[model samples]
Target: MRLSTVILPIHRWAEGQKIWRRAEDLGFHAAYTYDHLSWRSFRDGPWFGAMPTLTAAASVTQRMRLGTLVTSPNFRHPVTLAKELISLDDISGGRITLGIGAGGTGFDATALGQEPWTPRERADRFAEFVPLLDRLLTEGSVSYEGDHYSAHEARNIPGCVQRPRLPFAVAATGPRGLKLVARHGQAWVTTGDPTLYENGTPEQSVEALRGQAGKLADACAALGRDVSGIEKVLLTGFTPDRGRPLTSLDAFVDFAGRHQELGFTELVIHWPIPDSDFAADEKVFERIALEAPAQLR
Candidate 1:
C-alpha cells in the first residue's frame, strides 16, 4: 500500500510547517492537512486554513499530493472554492486531491454560525453540494439551481492543472457515511485507537477500522464503482516506546493488510499530534514524519 503523512495539524503551526518540509524530504507519498476552526485535543492552538497552507506547501514540495483531509460547503461558496482550488492546482502542477465531507460535529457548525444538523441531513446536503462542485471543477462552467446551491454560469477561471478534475475523496465514519464514500470519494479514511482492548490487544480498534473498510468495499461494488478508485487511510499512530511491550507498528501494519484485503489501494497514517504545550510532545511530529516513510515502504 502507498503511504502519506498527516500534516502536523494540531498545534505549533510553525513547527507543523517544518514537519511538512521534513516529510517531503523523506519522500512520503502525499502530504495531507485539515481545516477545523476549534478543538482542544492533544494538539491545540490556532489552526491554519487548509487551502492556503496547501498552497504554501505546494510551493515547497516538488512531488507530493497536497489535500485538505476534508473540505466542506459551509466554509466556502462553490464558486469561491473552485477559484482557490484552481489556483492551487495550477500552482501545484495538478498534484492535489480534494477530500471533502459534510460538516461534522456541532462545534464545527457553531464556529461557522450554522446549527448542527443530523448526520443524515449533513449527508443529504453533501449529496447536493459535492456534485455541483465536482461539475464546476471538471466542466469549468456550471448552471444549476438546487435546494442548497445555485449557480448561474459558474466559471472555473483558467481551469485547474489536473485535467478531468482532481480526485475526489470522502472521509466518512459510519454506514450511511460509507455509502457517501462509495459514491463520491476516490479515497476513504479511518481512525486508529491506541488503547489496549479488554482482551489486552489492540485488535478491537483495528477490527473496528477493518469493519468500516469492509462496508466501504461492499458499498463501492453496489454502486458500480471500481474499488481501486478509492484509497483507504488510517490514523492515530502513537507507537513510540516499545520495549517489546506492545509494538504499535505491528498493529498499524496489521490494519493495513486487513484494509488491503478489503480493497484499499493506499493507507495514510495519521498520528495524534499531542497536546502541544510541551517541546517534547511537539518533537513527536518529526519522529512520525521520519518513521512513516520507512514503514510505508
Candidate 2:
C-alpha cells in the first residue's frame, strides 16, 4: 500500500514549503491538503487557500504528487475550478490529483453568507458538479446546463497535462456518491463513519468501512466497471482510533495492515501538528513516513 500525508493549509508558505519538500524527501507517495475556506478548529487561525498552497508546493517538490484532500461545490463553480485545476496540473508537470466530495454543512457550507445545503441538496449539487467539471477539463469548449450548474461554451485550450485531465480521487460513502465514484473516480476516498468517530470502537469502524467498500463494489458492478480499477484510499484520523495510528511505528504498521487487509490501496495520515486534533510526535510521524510502508510490504 502507498502512504501519503495531508498537510493542513495552516502554515504560511515560508515554513510550509519545507514541509512539502520534506514529504517528498521522506518518500511519501503523495501529499495533500484540505480544501476549505476555513476548517474545523483552524477556522480562526492562519489557514491558506488550497490552490495557492498547492501551486507553491508543486513549484518546490519534484517527484511527490500533490492535491487537495477534497474540493467541493460549497463555494466553487466548476468553470472557475476547472481553469485553476488545469493550471495546477500543468505547473506540477502532471503530478496532480483532484480529491472531490459532496461537501458537508461545515463552515465552508455557509461561509459565503448563504444558508447551508441539506444533505439532499449537497448530493444534488455534487452530482451536477462532477460531470460538468469532467467535460470542462477534457473538452475544448463546453456549453451545458443542468439543474445545479450551467457552463456556456466554456473554453479550455491546451487542456490538462494528464491526458483525460488530472485523476479524480472522489470521496464518498453513500449510494448516489458511490455511483459517481464508479462512473468517474480514478480513486475512492473515505474517512470511515463520522457517526462512529466520537464513541465507537476501532473494530466497529473497520466493519463500517467494510460495508462502505462493499457498496462501492456493487456500484462498480452495476456499471460494468472493475472495482479494482479504482484505488481505495482511507484518509485516517476521522475514525474512532483517531491519531492512535501515528503514536509509534508499530502502531502505524498495525493500523495500515488492518486497513490494507480491507483493500485500502492508499492510507493518508495527517502531518503532525503540535496541539490540534492531529497532534502527534514529529519523530514518530517521520519514522512512520520512512519505515512503516516497508514493514507493511
All-Cα superposition RMSD per candidate: 4.3, 0.6
Off by over 4 Å in 1: 9-16, 42-44, 192-201, 237-262, 271-297
For each of the candidates, give the backbone clash count: 3, 0
Predicted candidate 1 versus true structure: per-residue lDDT over 203-225, tens digit per residue: 46556666677678788899898
lDDT of 2 by residue, 203-225 (tens): 99999999999999999999999
Candidate 2: Cα lDDT at 49: 96
Off by over 4 Å in 2: none
Please tell me which predicted candidate would have the highest lDDT against the true structure: 2
TM-score each candidate: 0.80, 0.99
Every candidate's lDDT: 0.67, 0.95
Deviation from truth (RMSD, Å), model 1: 4.3
